[model samples]
Target: MTVLVVTNDFPPRQGGIENFVRSLCDELPEVVVYTSREPRDAAYDATLPFPVVRDRTSMLLPTARITKRAVQLLQEHGADRVLFGAAAPLGLMGPALRRAGARRIVGLTHGHETWWAGVPGTRQALRKIAEAADTLTTVSSWCEDQIRPALSPAAAQRVRRLTPGVNTRRFAPNCGGEQVRKGLGLEGVPVVACVSRLIRRKGQDTLIKAWPLVQESVPDAKLLLVGGGPDRQYLEELAVRTGVSQDVVFTGPVPWAEIPPYVDAAEVFAVPCRTRRFGLEPEALGIATLEASAAGKPVVVGDSGGAPDTVRHGETGYLVDPYNPVAVGVRIADLLSNPQHCKELGAAGRQWVTEEWSWTRSGAVLRELLDV
Candidate 1:
């Protein structure tokens, strides 16, 4: 059961989908990948076990050359399953893959397909692809709900939920964050860490706004803002205006290999993501929250997107208003104050992730989906 994968999101980029696609490929034996990035240029290419075909086109979208080559690969390998790593890519090469003897045509619908569907042209094309594909899977319930209306009744029936998974062995309760703390100069302090790209939708500003209130409750507590984005300068300015500059530490864009230590550095992990529709940028199956939980840390997230699926409200972590700095502050303060409760919640999260959300489990589901 050879499988051919078409995807724009691949290594040399850092993201949830990129990691998920790679993990899925790692699970299957007969899989080949095609990507927009060239193999010679990417640093992570050598790390992958499967073969990959690189496109030479300058166009952002899939080109005719890619389509022809994909069909060639499918027919040549006798590949029965052709999995489009994303919904958008299917619009380009789906017809060719079907004609080339692909028994299973599958597309993965992440959160942003909902944003693309808002456009009249893209919406119709997405629907056509949905109707054509054998199945379409979503990483989050929010994404599944967002895409359902755009799909035909028959295509909608094929929709399935497959949330992103965490590598529990790599990210666990006993993993030490001494390096993360030493690098960020947050030694011997109660840290509230937020690990995500510092963007408007991720609600880093809301967390910064809530820092002063958090300070009054736990004065020595530090807000460790990890990851890089356009919001860095603005967030720094806001911290200055709010006069919590010394307390907020920014480690811009840590590498994927180093993410676990950052998670381990925190007593509480927070991702106060807000609902953004213009780009449809919801949390959509938060791998970070799961990673934090795996590392035995209590999580604090907003009510939007797939966050609720990861954090079990009061059981694992608190769900607060992403826009409300006061609420964010209060939750952090509560977690910081109660060491025993924090340990309890963190243990609960670790146990849950260990039992339920592992790459091994996700791989089994993906194999079942491809019927391989």
Candidate 2:
């Protein structure tokens, strides 16, 4: 089937949704992508297997023009199915695409996109998308629950849960832990790595606050923060004020290719995500935590959102309160202090991801949905 995925974010641009869409393309055949971002050079466009239709419109164009361009692209592609990456803006184009020869419409909801209950127009737009689409799929069961209340009776019945899959081949256990550790200057010190955007919602500050407690017990433990964002300076200051500056190392925005190695190097991976009303905390699945687990590293994630669905509490790793730094620190220290327990937890995590979260498996599920 020819599927046209509409998304605001894509590879060359980084985020969970971007990664999810890119991985989805890797699994399916005859897939075409329409994105808002344009490449600097034309040559880069040829690199992807599918045709990348770019929409470059200035801010001057009203919402109607943008919707028209999206509809035009859907009509031009002759897509059998149109998948909106999120409910908002992209899903707003759903009715237009359906009018333009697309047979089946699917809106992919990711956490907060569907959690806009109080917003007047936003809720109405989401309801429109849900009502218009043949199917509504979310990345996690958590998201399914969030959107269910707002969905029309018929739309709620069609809503399905399709968790994001991890590329096990790219993020496997054999990435060499010692080599990655040495490369990141974390040879002797026990490393606790957090791989996410340095943002408030990600709970990096919460992790930084927890570091002092972890330090009291494991003074030599190092915190490696991967990825960068607007909250870089603020997080750095938080680390300093918390008196864990020397223990914290911020490796700003590492390439996607290098992220796996960093995950492999860590003794434990932390994702202390907080809730956002418009944005779902923990989204559907915590891809980074899954990736870290797949790399044979135990994960320490927050209790909110869809994290508990993956973390498995004591089995795979610990789930802590994102707002509480002391609990976060204590959990990190527990994993760090016991190497045998860490290995056991890491093994369990790797097993869970490999068995349940493979891209090949996700492709089969997606194909089944499209076939129906």
Best by lDDT: 1
In model 1, which runs have C-alpha deviations exceeding 4 angstroms?
38-40, 57-60, 277-279
- Model 1: lDDT equals 0.84
In TM-score terms, candidate 2 sits at: 0.94
> Against the true structure, what is each candidate's TM-score?
0.95, 0.94
Q: Any idea what lDDT model 2 has? A: 0.79
Residue 148 alpha-carbon offset, candidate 1, angstroms: 1.4
C-alpha lDDT values of all predictions: 0.84, 0.79
lDDT of 2 at 311: 85
Error of 2 at 150 (Å): 0.5
Q: At residue 27, give the lDDT of candidate 1.
A: 83
Off by over 4 Å in 2: 38-44, 58-62, 277-284
lDDT tens digits, residues 1-372, model 1? 999988877776777787888778888879988777644445577666778777775223656767888888887877889888887755557877788788888788787787766778888888988877888898877788878888889989999887778888888865769877887788899999989988898888998899888888899999999999999999999999999989889999987887888899999999899888654677777789989999999999988877788888888898999988899999999899998999999999999998888888888878888888
